[model samples]
Target: MTRIPELLAPAGDAAALDAAIRSGADAVYLGASLFSARSQAANFAAPQLGQAIDKAHLHGLSVYLALNTLIAQDEMETALQIAGRAAERGVDAIILQDAGLAAELHRYLPDLPLHASTQMTVTDRAGLNMAARLGFSRVILARELTIKEIEGVTAEAKRHHLETEVFVHGALCMSVSGQCLLSSLNGGRSGNRGACAQPCRLPWTLDAAQKDPFPWLSPCDQSLLDGIPDLTRIGVRSLKIEGRMRSADYVGQVVAVYREALDRLQDNNPLNRQERDRARERLLLAFNRGGRFSDRPISGQMGRAFLAGSYSGSYGLFLGTVLKSDPVTGVLTIRSDKASNRTVTRGDVLSVRMSGEDKERASAPVGKISQTSDGWRVQGFHPDVLRTITPGLQVYQMGSQ
Candidate 1:
C-alpha cells in the first residue's frame, strides 16, 4: 500500500486538540502557555499539555508541542523547562525555531524527536541537510517554496535521511520565513517566534496620493489542496495547516476536506469535479481571503492582496454548527450558532461537522427537491445523491418545517 502523508492539524487549545484528532488528523501541533510564540492562542498549561498528550495517544494520533518561537536570554530557562516537560509527557516531538534551542533540547532530551519549524527558513537542500545534522529529525520547508524547489529539497532531505514536512494549506506569509519584521515594525509584535501580528493582512500604501484611495497590500491564503498529489509524489511526510486561532468547526471542516481530497487522489483517481468544487466551497466558508471565489489558484493577484488585508492581533473564524438538514424534500438547513452571521447559502458548500467532543460525528447533505409530492416525499434526484445519505433513516434539516 502507498504511504499517505501525515495530516498535521493545529490545536490551539484542549478543545482544538480533540477537534484535530476527531477530524482524522494523523497528528496535531500545539504550544505551551509560555515559550511558544502564539501568545494569543489558548495555549495549554503544563498539566493540560500532559492531559492532551494522553488524550491524543488514546486516539492513536501523535502530539507535537510547539517550542518554535525565539528564546531570549531570560527565556532560555523557561524554554528548556517546557521542552523537558514535553519529553516527560511523552510528546512525539518538539518543533523549534531556534537552532540553539533545538541543540539545547537535543542534548537534554536525545530520545525526543526534534522538528525544525518553518521559522528556520529552510530554503535549500544545504540548509535542510544542516538542520538534519543538527539533530532535526524533520524540517518543515518554508511556505514560499515552489513545486520545483520542493522536489529538490525533498530529494536532498532523503539523501541526508531526514524527514521533510510542508505547509499544504494555510495563511501565506508576506515576507520570507524568519526574515519578516513587518509585524514588529508595525505593531511591536515579532513574527519570528509566532507572535506575528500579521501586518501583511493589513492594507498598505506606497504613494501619498494613492495611500487613502488604493490600499497597497493584499495576500492570498495558500491552499495546496490541489497540489497534495504532487507533494505526495515528492515524498513529503507531513502536510501542515495554518490557523492556530481558528475554531474547531473550521478545523474539522478543513481537515475533512483535505482528508477526503488526499484519499481520492491516493487511489489514483482524479478529484471528480464535484469533489474539487466541494473542497473549494468549504474552505471559503471556513474563512478565506478574496480570490476567484475561493476555488481559484492558492496565490496570485487578487488572492494575494486579500490575504494581506491587515493584522488585527486576533483574526480567524468562529465556532458554528449545522442546526439542521433534511434531504427528503431537497432543502439544507444551517445556523451559525455564533454571534456573527458571516454568510450561509444553498449550493455554497457543506462539510461533515467533526467535533472534539464527538469523534464519530458525521453529516449528510440536505438537497432541495425539484418536485414535491403530496406529502414530504420529493422526486427528481440525481443518482450520485446516494452518496450523501447516511445509513440512518433520520435526515438532518433546517427551516420552518
Candidate 2:
C-alpha cells in the first residue's frame, strides 16, 4: 500500500494540456496569460484559461494555474482578479511566487490550496516553515537542491503538515530561480516579470573572442527518470516537469515515460533494461535540447554536461555520421547506428554539422532515400546545403517525427 506520488506535467496551452492528460498526467500546471513564468509561451487568455480548467477537470486531473510571476505595484488588482477567477473556475490550486499575491489569494479564496512556486527559491527548513505560515499548503522546492537537501526539506515540510513538490525533470537555469537578471540586462525582458528572453541559451563572448562557444552557462536539463522510487519513498508528494514552453509532443512523451515509470515502481517492477532503452528513445525523439543530465543539481555537472554541438536549442537525436556527399549527384551517404532505414521520411528535417565543430552546420528536409552498398543514400539535401555539406559531418534529426 505504498503511495504513488502524483505525476504533474506542464501545459503551456490547450494543445499541451490535452496531450498531458491523454498521456496520463495526474495533474497539470499551466500559464494564465498575464502572470506566467514563461511569458513567451502560448499562455491562456482569461477565457481560454477558464475553458482549460473545465477541460482538465473533465478528465479528473487537477489543474494548477501558474500565477507565479511577481506582481507590479499597479498590477495587484489584475493579479488578484486572475487568482479569483481561477478559483471560481474550480481550479484545484494556484502556484504563487509573490508572498503578497499568495496572502491576498488565501484571504479571498480560503478554500483554494496555494502551492509556493520554485520561483521563491525555497530549500531549507526555515523557508518551508515561512511558506506554510504564509498560508501555503504545498511548496515546490527549488531545483538547485541536492538529493540530501531535498530529503531534509521534505522531512521538515511533513512536520508542518505541508506537502513537498520537486522538479524531477526538465531544463535548469544558470542562476537560481527568481535570482536571474541576465535576460533583463541583455534585453529589456525581465525573467522575474515573466518576459525572459532566454539570453542564457545564446552564446556568450568576451571583448575579443567568444567566451563560451557552447551554452556553458545554460545547465543541462534534469532527468531523474531512474529516481522515481526514491523520491516517492522519501515522501515527495508531487513530481513536476518543467517545460511549459515546449511542444505538446514533448509534453506527451515525457508524461508517458514518467507515468509508466511511476506505475512500475509502485508495482515493484521497474522497467527492464530493454524497456528503459526504448523509453529513452521515445524521449530522444520527443526532445533532447540539452546534452547530459544529472540526478540532482548539486553534482556540479551542469556546465560540463551540455550536448556536443547545437547547444542553443533542440538538437533532436543524433542519427549518424555522413560518409559521403555529392552536390552534383544530389545525394548524401549516412550511417545510422540503429540499422534501420525505416527512419527515413520525406520532409523530415535534419541538421548536418561538421563532426569536429557542431557550429558549422546546415539543415535540410529529407526528400528521398534509397538502399546503398554502404548505407542509406539520402537525396534532396536542403538546396542551401547540397553544395556546402562536407563528409564526416554529424547529422542530427531536429524535433519529433
Cα lDDT computed for each candidate against the true fold: 0.68, 0.80
Pairs that clash in candidate 2: 291-307
Candidate with top TM-score is 2
Q: What ranges in model 2 sit over 4 Å off? A: 206-214, 298-303, 306-310, 326-330, 338-348, 370-374, 399-401
lDDT of 1: 0.68
TM-score of each: 0.75, 0.90
| Model 1: lowest-lDDT 10 consecutive positions | 392-401
lDDT of 2 by residue, 1-401 (tens): 56799999999988999999999999999988788888889989989999999999999999999988888878989988888888899989999899998888878888889999998988898898789878999999988887778888999999989999988778777788656899899988989988888777776654566654555466557678766777888899999998999889889989999999888887888888877767766666666655345554744344455532345566576777888787878888888746533365676667877655646378777778787655578876754567777777787776434
How high is the lDDT of residue 155 in model 2?
Answer: 93
lDDT of 2: 0.80
